[model samples]
Target: MEKLILTRLNVLGHPGRMAVFRLLMRRLPDAVPAGEIGQALAIKPSTLSVYLSALCGAGLIGQRREGTSILYSARAQAGGEIVDFLFNDCCRGRPETCAPVSRVFREGFPDMSDRKYNVLFICTGNSARSIFAETILRDQAGERFDVYSAGTRPYSQLDPFALEVLKAKGHDISGLRAKNVSEFCAPDAPQMDFVFTVCDQAANEECPAWEGQPVSAHWGMPDPVKAEGTDAQKSLAFQQAYGALRNRILSFTALPLDSLDRISLQKAVDDIARETPEVTT
Candidate 1:
């Protein structure tokens, strides 16, 4: 029986099948059509069909016939099994190192139940650090709070290096765009809970006070795109920025907001802003 189970697992180890499975895992609940998967991965339809068939045969994916199209999604049980398999031997046999990250999803803000708490990151260009913070917060605190990012002066483009680093780390940034913060500070803007200036210039500049007099903080990061040197040196700058922001956001999300008073939470955010390490070469 053990041998038979190993044989079944081996079927999913194929590169093509693994790719299809990972894509489906990332897009749970949504049934991806066969053609879309092929296009996204640049796999030929005929080739993808073979891999999809293998996955279906192994019961790792579920297929639905929608009209003439066949849609596929990761089987929830199979997905769990895959995760277990991947991490079963991780941490060099230290079980504690494999614990899952925790998230908070509770009612009410730190003090005000009636007011919703929203976090907005502002920068001169919304292409790098601001965007990183926005996405990382969403990933870390998706259930408890709302997060957004924009620029005082919007850039015409996103830094390709930033996009590449995010993709390499398995974070999706599709449909994200650089927009001006003016859109949020307009008279009809949604009441912000916190406004974070993520660049030195934006932090120091005098701007219209946000609606509702939201608590403001400055979390400045050196502009990674401004790093000068070879291609590899510039790429390292983006990675350093990403790592620094990720660590700070991790610490911020771990705050015991539900138990802390408003004053405590404010102090905590300030300390977090002041103490996070500056990324460097």
Candidate 2:
């Protein structure tokens, strides 16, 4: 166990490798292409190759080939084990001594079971990624949230793969369609407590001022609609998007909203985008 921990530590001890690992963690559950990572971190391809190799060798990250791109992501289980070791060693089985850290991990959201919160998801097309988020949240916590989604430039129809994947998962696909952002910005539209942009374009676009000053964050992901490959591969992109959105929506809904102040709540929501937790199969 100690050797395993030492291996991970040694791999992260280098500054460049640490940057690579941290970048991967920020984009968790999304397997980033190596070239994209290099551009984001301004690292040369040759040096970045060494860093990626070291991380993979230490079992700190995993890579898979998607089309022509080799994608990489942090290994959540490995990271969890290292954290567990360090925390356990610090507390020495006296759980009470680790109370502060425990609270942070718990994310202590206040229980607001009585009233429903409004959530809106936005994307450029609204045909795939944002639609997935809306459906998942509605299905997962419909009783607690009044969920909606819209696009900056709405598509005429829903993506077939988006509908197929959700229906396959036994989620009702009825009444789902692409809608414009203006629909939600009207005088009588439902007030939103939270708004999330699920695509880079939507996040960058100037948004109409929402009524209630909703807590907003960018939960951007690749547009599955643009994915090119076989029908099976294209469908796989939607499936992956569905999985990632479901995991994030579950985490968001699980929070105790009644317990947190606006500042804490805002930070918590923002953190969700940054720390994309490991998605289970």
Residues 148-169 of candidate 2 have per-residue lDDT tens digits of: 9999999999999889898899
Model 1 stretches with alpha carbons more than 4 Å out: 1-116
Instruction: List per-prediction Cα lDDT, in the order shown.
Output: 0.73, 0.81
- TM-score between model 1 and native: 0.58
Model 2 bad stretches (over 4 Å): 1-114, 278-281
**What tens digits encode model 1's per-residue C-alpha lDDT throughout 20-65?**
7876754443567888788767899989999988888777889999
Best by TM-score: 2
> Number of clashes in every candidate structure?
0, 3
Global Cα RMSD, each model: 18.7, 9.9
